[model samples]
Target: MAENKRDYYEVLGISKNADDAAIKKAYRVLAKKYHPDANPGDKNAEKMFKEASEAYAVLSDPEKRRQYDQFGHAAFEGGAGGSGGFGGFDFSSFEGADIFGDIFGDLFGGGRRHSGPSNGPIQGANVRTSVRLTFEEAIFGCEKEISINYKEECSTCHGSGAKPGTTPETCTKCNGKGKVMYTQQSFFGTVQNVQTCSACGGSGKVIKDKCSACRGSGYVIKKKTFKVKIPAGIDNGLSVRMAGGGEPGVNGGPRGDLLVSAVVSDHPIFKRQDINIFSTVPVSFTKAALGGKINIKTVDGEVEYEVKPGTQTDTKIRLKGKGVPSLRSSSLRGDHYVTLVVQVPTMMTPAQKEALRAYDEAMNAFTKNDEKTRKKGFFSK
Candidate 1:
């Protein structure tokens, strides 16, 4: 298998020294090109898509990439490097699903995590979407309503897929097991493959008089609105999961979850680092020399801050408990840091220049007197 497979870097059209971002970019481009949705019924394109996905599944991970670089494909070959082949590449892992979801959604409508017994109840598929929040809203927390289009159980047949007056019968091909077992010749002698019943599509039942509303699919595309509560201090790119807020499950299984990813807009005045808030305030040269109370904008509102006398440019002041509240613990809050920047006069009127000259002369005289005093001291002598 290793001898026949192409190199991961060669598949993605990248170098061995390619960074994570580069690999992701190359994968995205290739995935979009060879995606089944983009090239429907093209077997070659489908194979390429799976190949690229497999390559990305390994190279995108740091540990797997390290092993691959050290031992090549032999690292993943069974018993070749004393490691189980492809066992660590779990498709259900958050990293793997997140990377695959964006591309696979277009091909499969949405990604599905298959689990449970073959003939038993199965959990519904999860739904994914994104939400953009204002910086203030993310800091203070707010409720938002988002609309999503998803599949729901048909009302006419109540998810049975049978006609109103009729019911479904157990699939004869698999004897209601929903799967068929078969054996194939392999190097180890024989391998068993369990496949879904083609007659019933793994539903374990076949409907002769199908429901007109759902066309025997038991589900219909429906639009729904859900109110989402965004936690305070929820940062950008973080996802919020809503349990049992997805599609209806099969055979009485629990519904899936809804994952809403947040995109927090940047604030013009304030920048956030973890829970801390940072902002720069401009102060005049006179204010730096003779400091007084100044108005500063905070998340809550404008607040007055006192600058120490003789405060210099680039001076930083901290306001305790003025930053964002912690998402985990609302009682705990971070401090706000304000950096003061003293503005120098770029242009001056004639009167202002004359006043500055007089002030300079006064400062020169005071400095000279101080020097003479210091020189007269015994230590200086």
Candidate 2:
């Protein structure tokens, strides 16, 4: 059967005996010519670009190139073709690999290996704590100091994990790269494996004399106190983030954030809903019927509100801008809803009972007279 794929050397316009530099130069020129960016929507140019990439992907690596030279495409055709192959190739996975560095570096900018500590700084873990606030304290912001146990850089070694006078040395195993690379032969091709260096445990450094205080870990549990400001209008279960206030970072990275979850205590007299304050005010039956002024307690102070005559129980009255202030804007506030509840005396003295009875008799007589006037309506008028 005729071979289904062209030789990798032919794809890059290079001789079979070409050196690594020659192969790279040829691939770069071809890649620039057939790059999707340069070709726009030309399908043939895209196909040529992919074919060249596949050829360079195999030939640029010494092991893959050796295997390809010995067995051609058959080296990656069957079970012998290990996990390494263009079948599952992702250009992103080749980001830091030296095989595609030169060509892709020109096509998509610089390419650098992502293995080991060179991958970049890692952020520290976040710490969470709950703050309990009284309802009044939540309505008006307050500051409270909280104690937390978190990881802090060791003062003895200044986070170097070495003795006070001594210092850490670069790892001999990985040469301070924090990772060791090794090649493994598989059915598909040669696969490069990058793993954390066993000697320095991926820190890229080894301490000869460990710090007595931190035991070379570079961090210690510390009790820290921080004052957190509880903002107004904050509700239960809401979180307040304190930037760079949590655990100390690793490898000189930035500290993580401290998350304070609010736990607002319930108030006996007032209930809150999204910046609004609700409360029930009790008024005597006579006050509700005859109309009178009653004192209402608010976050600001006690205020007088006029009860409408003949007001029914559960009547709601709004006190505008008397509620909790907005967290975003302190000047903005919500309304306070006061529900009026009329209280009737369960026990009455004889004089009080007689007065109520006389009032009831007068109301009955007035109702009867009004009914008679309505009955005689049209003709009488």
Q: Rate the local accuracy (lDDT) of all candidates.
A: 0.83, 0.82
Worst 10 residues of 2 by lDDT: 92-101
For model 1, name the residue pairs that clash.
none
TM-score of 2: 0.68
TM-score to native of every candidate shown: 0.67, 0.68
Which residue pairs collide, candidate 2? 80-187, 80-188, 81-187, 81-188, 82-187, 82-188
Residue lDDT tens for model 2, 1-381 = 118788888899889999988987888788778877778899899889778878887787777788888878877765456444565554444421454334445667754335335525768889999999999989988998888997888888889989999989999999988888766543223545566678987778899999999999888998889999988888889988999988777677899999999999999999999999999999999999999899999988999988889999999999999999998897899999999999999999999999999999999999999898888895587
* Candidate 1 structure quality by residue, lDDT tens digits, 237-349: 99899998887787778899999999999999999999999999999888888888899999989999888889889999898999989988989998899999999999999
Off-target runs (Cα >4 Å) in candidate 2 are: 2-119, 180-201, 379-381
